[model samples]
Target: MLITDDDEGDRRLVARALKEGHLSCECVEATSIEEAIFACSEYAFDCAIIDYRLPGRDGLDGIASLHQRFPYMSIIMATGQGDANVATEAMKLGASDYIAKAQITGGSIRRIIENALEKAAMRRKLALQQEELENFAAVLVHDLKAPITSVRAFAVLMEHSVGAEITDKDKLIGQCRRVANAARRMDDLIDTVREYTRADGQLLSGPVEMDRVIEDTLSNLHQMLLLRGARVTHGRLPFVLGNASQLAQLLQNLVGNGIKYCEAAIPTVHVEANPDENGAWVFAVKDNGIGISEGYYQQVFQPFKRLHDKSKYEGTGLGLATCKKIVERHGGRIWCASADNQGTTFFFELPACPAIA
Candidate 1:
């Protein structure tokens, strides 16, 4: 390990302290960023302790340079206790830990260094797991496309082969259509799960107009809406950051649930957004349908967890799960507020908009 500071005396003092504290860390003194890089090229190090105030270069600048070359190396920033902003910036710049220069004794410094090393190890393990999951998802999704394509091809052929003049043609065609829909649902569930479980996550979020997203989702569900006489209304809305496809899917799940569970009355769904106390945007999907029980709220978010039997609801149970993932990925939280028959409101919150365009 290397410890760099503009003060020669401080470097020696820290090195001696660490050595006495049973740390086998080989201390390298670099008063400037250039010296730090030179030391790194000259010898290998598991970590680097950078002082916030360095001559000719700030600690964060040196850390940035070091990170580009040695991303695996743990970085611990030394800062004055009063400089909270500097410490926060260092952490955001990927520093493993921040130590208050005045408060850190020799022993405390060693402990910090050890803790940083442990964190680095855990991060590496997470990276490996993420890679494995990505590889698995890519293969699984790609493999699924082949069989689904064949099934769809055969289904279309059957539809054409059976003439409309034949009796029971409508019934037979509807049954085949149902099978095709089921296959498509499976594909959608697999793709959504694959995207959600990603380690770095699906960074597909972009500027999404509120009205456009809801309009598009509802348009796609036009047949179902018409069949159930579901009315969806909205008012003036704000543009938010989100992925259009994922947003449409999330909406489809919530609104579609309302349509599927509606009793004798026409299904009514509404979408709206407002600002919360934290200044973040809060969106809620309200539905007038068979409402979910309070005890099932938590369970609904789990993949394939259904409150009603498959015969009654007619779902694969991945819709709400996908919604949960999408909301969480956007730095938001979602929960259901509802009473049976009265209605259900699924509310979700997204972080405050970026200050800049």
Candidate 2:
């Protein structure tokens, strides 16, 4: 923890009060903003308590600089008596909390610090939620707009060429196909979003039979596999502790993506598992496709993030995000390894079932 105070007596008083309050902290003292910055650079402090009055610059001015430097660190500004305006401005300038130095007590200071920490944590969580909501909204708009635009364009062409002497049969058929594909894309977006949200929060934990899940997933995606002429090969997969339905969905999404993104190449996907050092099974879903770039390895797992053109690869972009959520729900980690054109392998780990152990 960092404490900045210009007066030696006030600094000592704050330190003594914290000690009397029985709050154990590795406190670092700083007399000015520069000293505080140096201390912050040297150590990772949980919170910084700053005195309102300083020699060259006041605490309110320092709040902005400190906040910019360490945005996540909680800051509590200490103001003198009857300095309500200063306290208010400190908060506006990104101070987490403020206290009047005249009213300082051991218990009051401890409670204030605890309150600041709790509020800071809540703020960070809200920020993350807002960002996720914004990302979803942006993607929803783009995905929805693309299909509607395609449908409208095709409809306009068909209407203009209807009953015309120069009507081309092949062109009309091509336009109808485009319209049908666009409608399918729209329907897929709605279905994917519905299913993604439905299973997102539901955690069904059990001894999930790996073989049964794979068989069911393959059955569900059989049509797509046939349409794409994709072949899946797998060896013996071990049973693990997880939700059966979610695991099936996870594999289905991976396999579906593997087939869809192949760019005319015959899709060949392999599913295999091996035991890790910690008794957990590391499963890999390897696919021979037009692989993803190294920079987008993590981005592809984000909802509605697409590295390729939507026309080339038809999807709501929620498949990998759903897979990630499922893996996290099962207390596992997921990652990818791939080059630009060289195939990709997605690896995830799950704990072995107790019976198997």
Instruction: Tell me, by lDDT, which candidate is best.
Output: 2
Candidate 2 local lDDT, 136-175, one digit each (tens):
8887998899899999999998888785744688988898
lDDT of 1 by residue, 162-236 (tens): 755446767667757766775875676666566455413556877777678888888889999888888888766
In model 1, the Cα lDDT at residue 129 comes to 67
Q: lDDT score of model 1?
A: 0.78
Assess every candidate by TM-score.
0.53, 0.77
Best by TM-score: 2
Error of 1 at 153 (Å): 22
Worst 10-residue lDDT window for candidate 2 reads 159-168
Q: After superposition, how far is residue 234 of candidate 2 from its true place, in Å?
A: 3.7
